[model samples]
Target: MKEQIRCAVLGLGRLGYWHAENLATRVKGATLVYVADPFEKQAEKVARELNIGKSTKNPNEVFEDPTIDAVIIATPTSTHAEMIQLAAKHKKHIFVEKPLTHDLQEAVQVIQTIKENNIFCQVGFMRRFDSAYMEAHNRIQAGDIGTPLYFKGVSRDPGSPPAEFIKNSGGIFLDMSIHDYDISRYLLGSEVTSISAHGNILFHSFMEPYHDVDQAIAYLTFDSGAAADIEASRNAFYGYDIRGEVIGSEGSIQIGSLRHHDIQILTKSGSTHDIVPAFPERFKNAYLNEIEHYIDCLRNNEKPSVDEMDGKIALEIALSAKKSFETGRKVLLSNPTLSLD
Candidate 1:
């Protein structure tokens, strides 16, 4: 096992910057050696702020560097497949954000390439590492929840992203609901067999040109006969709210809270509490834990908990949901790994 895993970060955007910060400061056994972004200034700024030795506008520099053992890919969804394949080709382990690729064919190809390379690839499904969700998962596995039956998830973003981002976000299901789909599968211990979805433009006119909706809902059926309903929105005026509930034959487990802290103030007028403002605030620990897990896997020469197959299946589920919404019907996934042909 390597004494320390040298790491590089690609795409220093919102999530990318956060990941770079974690690697530089919080995650042990990880050394943030390189940072890259198309915007020269952004990359240089991040590099300077994080005290990284190297920063570049081109991603090739990171992959070409033999000293770097791994990379955290926080690039856009459309670019995920190419970046992952490139990293794999360089024999660098990868930690990429969710929905492996926007296209199923590309996702299939990416999976094959990763397998051929035989490098560790971890998908960013941070919810699985969250303390609350992990507790629920452990209890459910221990039979505390008996036989899982139903899953309900709610994910509401306070506001929509810019038009440029929405145009390439792969719509709401892939962009937002993919996490819920993955977590539903994780907690219910089942593969998504079919999905029915619905969505509307709602408040964001900018999304219409992109055919993306500001809000959506998906109903999913699992191979274990478990069911799930997930709701996603980009117009949560109050705050960034995320919650999940798993109901079982014996009992139920609820996860998440709107408040950032446990304490709430009570008054004669009403009760008030600080609401989670965004994803970073809501899943801070989860983000840190996921990166640490990736580093640990590298040092121990072990495969990541969330691998290429999980990423592929989650993308498939999201694509199915999008199809259902477009066709106004339920889409069945007869073969989880159905061929592109």
Candidate 2:
């Protein structure tokens, strides 16, 4: 039998729990050997639930463990760069959830460490592996959507996160719109040249204190002369709505909708279908595929599709949008890699 790479998942939060569970049972050629969280009880709880052999509240335990070959970092945004650099120093491959680092310089530092250590790293832009988005990307690449000119994306949550989370989330652009930034780049196959952002606090007045917004729209100009219109919202009360489309000279393609399932109920009230409650359920398959790809790369000694550079670019676009929102102007990327901070 082939050996499986011993893996540890840092942070036993909701996303980390899911990451560990996926690596534990779903992703072949990978083994979940340890799990960690700052809260000892929380770490113990999920470690027991996952049937993982080792669990610790101290992140250092996972980083120092010689048996572990890699780590999945699903920690809070602030801790990402630290965890990643530590894992790289340990000679472990890494798979990090997105928005790489809240600071661009830190992302550059992390990427440097990964390179110096000769380790593999994959960022969690799971949409790239989603069947629907993949189809659009493939078709666009194949010229099915000839000469792509415009891109549109929508992501609205059925509910809002805690006020505390928002305080530390680096605002809507990095927290929410970052996903769209990456998706736009993926579908358009281009980098954003300039960005202008408009934001308002339609609801969620709590954001006022932090200068964040409940809704935002960003306009992006790409190097390919293509433009993208992105829409983001914190409340979709109906459900977790996520969709994207690409418009080109020949035709266009669109994805997602309010409908959650095929079966629509018909009655005097009118036809209605369920709505996907949240992101986890909506992108479940993509999550699985991404983790599987990580394991495959580990086993084959191949580079994962989305690496640190991808994470850095996506982050730069997001930071630029944030800068735009703050300044009410179009921020130019004088250097694609230039840090807005």
Quote each prediction's TM-score. 0.98, 0.97
- At residue 169, give the lDDT of candidate 2: 88
lDDT of each: 0.93, 0.89
Clashing pairs in 1: none
For 39-77, candidate 2 gives per-residue lDDT tens digits of 999889888888889899898998888988889999999
- Cα RMSD of all models vs. native, in order, equals 1.3, 1.7
Instruction: Tell me how far the alpha carbon of residue 236 in candidate 2 is from the true structure, in angstroms, after superposition.
Output: 1.0
Against the true structure, whose lDDT is highest? 1
Please report the TM-score between candidate 2 and the true structure.
Answer: 0.97
Model 1 C-alpha lDDT per residue in residues 212-295, reported as the tens digit of each score: 899999999998999999999999989999999999999999999999888889999999999999999889899999999999
Stretches of candidate 2 off by over 4 Å are 335-341
Q: Which stretches of candidate 1 lie over 4 Å from their true place?
A: 337-341
- Reference-based TM-score, model 1: 0.98
